[model samples]
Target: MNDALLALTPTLELPSVAREQALKKQTNISDYDFLLGWLYPEDELLPPNLALFSKTTGPVFIDFLGGKKNHRRQFGGGKGQPLARAVGIASDFTPKVIDATAGMGGDAFVFATLGCEVLMIERSPIVAALLQDALNRAHLELQLEAEGKTYRFDDDEHSFLTATISRMQLVNADAADYLNHTKPEADAIYLDPMYPEKKKKAATNKEMTALQGLVGPDIDSSKLLEAAMTVAKKRVAVKRPAKAEPIQLESGKKPSASIQSPNTRYDLYVVASTQS
Candidate 1:
């Protein structure tokens, strides 16, 4: 089989060890070999197409199952903001969004609709490659179906997904590894790791169950906020269970001073940069 990537841009590389470790974490008996577009020899699904999710809108249930929202109304694309809104990201639908982890790209798509220029970074090679593919296909189809419209994908000059959401950029890279170095000051940064679901809602829907077989749990999710703090021009928003204590604050790193929405209980950490 040709390891020759099918796309038109440079494939994002992963640390061989991390890639192996990440892949090993996949609970599937057959690996995500399908990501390479390997024809599945059995009766199972291939990597998902963007079209399936292209139509999704309104409050994102995918996040409710996994527990995160990428684009809040404050960012212009959310039905509701993430937990961090209490600290002051606000519900006015601020501006652009950077989705550090694109898992299934559900959150990213929501923000795209709010007309935010969303920059989505995903680390898994198969997942990234598949997202790029779907974005490319959907971007092209949407463009062709319209007049004088285009969005870049496949490393092209413009993307339809970007145009559809006003503007978007999908960069293939590890969420933790990439955000550590990136400094694009977005209005908001959204982070949602695969948390242990509340037992009441443990049985996930079909797509999520499939996603679980792919990305596994976001084992390194805790580190995302610190990185987001340094980059986001506005705030670092994390969505958590309504009952769970705020992530870093629970450990006492954040000051005792609190913000609004204490009753909702999810926390939003306002990085100093966005305040200006």
Candidate 2:
């Protein structure tokens, strides 16, 4: 584990059950700088969720069962969504995707919901723990729904959530290393390297702020992209800020095409051959 990761300690307020879970997760992680613990909701019936707490920021956690994730899953423009299109999801084709920088697994979930099998790779054990916890909780809800037991969420929600979780896989490893060593076969490889924050813009959301602090910038993103290019059978899509330039490659290669949205851009590197 990184030195920064080694410094984390569980919060004192974590309940017994959550504490146990956090400790179990810690067995795999060496350290962390922030508080690794669970946050219980005001409603006693709700299950406790894992979070990373810092002095300045609110609790940072991944939540797929409720909140914005649910809303996006239910009505985020379906396959027509920008991310979906960028990764080549269509009626005739749904590419299996590898999310190389699967931060909070937010975009990976989106692809999963759209019926794409997604492999999420995260290097940080801290963030991966939070993501795994969220997935575990979501799976529990799915299992409850299968047993016809009462759940906090509605019936219609379970169908998609179940399918989505089933299609998503998480792995904790460095993206470049994983891609190069495993050589996993996938139709698309998605990269969303963390770019430097703008000084003039307002502060980013709590999740992003905490994530940036924990993982820092993706300085080796170019190397990761090179590995991805060699692995992806069809294309590699890199997410960039709307105004930011595309990632520079040492080979001096350029994207085959670019897709733009209001806030983001996707630089598509159409793989000419898998051998590359």
Candidate 3:
């Protein structure tokens, strides 16, 4: 780990019974501070307050199965949203999206809920572990929901949540390396590189502030874009703030088109051929 990451390392706290599972699944625990606390398989922190949480930002988690923000996004005009349109969700084809920089997996969850199979890759071990914990908890909740034992959702909602969770996959890997080696071609490759911080106070929210402090910005995002162009079958979509310029490209590569929303834009780069 780098010096910056070493300084910001998180402590993994799991229940005594789950210690073996944590050790087997989390190989990087030795590099971090280990604590003993129970994470009650449900999407919550158990008693004694032991959870897979961030010291800087308390109790970081992923909850696509609930919350008003996520629910509003999933059941609202998501399919007609600019991101969906940029990835050709309106077309006769169902696109499989690869979220190269799945920091919090928020966008990946959005795509998955919209019926697009999304594969997420995160490079930061801390962030990856947090995301993995969130995903595991989410899957468990979905399973319980499917069996009508948790989260009072209608039958249609339950089925939709189950399908959405099934469509999503996560991996802790460098985006460039994964793209270089992955065999199956993704219909759309998505990039959401961290935007450079503004020079003013309160420039962003708490979550983003904590995130930028941890992972920093994706300085090599252009290289990631290059790798995506090589593997994506239909297009590579890059998400950016509406006013920000599109991602930098090498000498010849360029984005084919752009889809714009009030707050963000999707720069679509079409690949030359289907074969790698």
Candidate 3, residue 273: lDDT: 75
Best by TM-score: 2
lDDT of 3 by residue, 1-276 (tens): 223223334432232223334435454444433323334444343112223433344334456666653666656686787878888787577799999999877788888888899999998766676666667766766676667566567888777877888888888889998898884469999999998787874556445655787778889989999998888888899988888888777755667889988988899988777435
Q: How do the residues 1-276 of candidate 1 rate in per-residue lDDT, one tens digit apiece?
A: 223343412453311112222334443323332222222213232222221111111111122111233233224334454333432333576467888877767667666655567788887665666566656545444554354433212433234333544455788777666777767768778776677545476456655655555567776666777777777766666756556666653235562233334333445667665444
Which regions in candidate 2 have their CA more than 4 angstroms from the true location? 1-33, 41-46, 274-276
TM-scores, one per candidate = 0.61, 0.85, 0.78
lDDT of each: 0.52, 0.81, 0.70
Clash statistics: count for each candidate:
11, 6, 2
- What shift in Å separates residue 4 of candidate 1 from its native position after superposition? 8.1
Give the backbone clash total of model 3: 2
RMSD of each: 9.6, 6.2, 7.3
lDDT score, candidate 2, position 162: 86
User: Candidate 2: global Cα-lDDT?
Assistant: 0.81
Clashing pairs in 3: 14-37, 15-37
Ranking by lDDT: 2, 3, 1
By lDDT, who's the top model here? 2
Error of 2 at 66 (Å): 0.9
Ranked by lDDT, the better of candidates 1 and 3 is 3
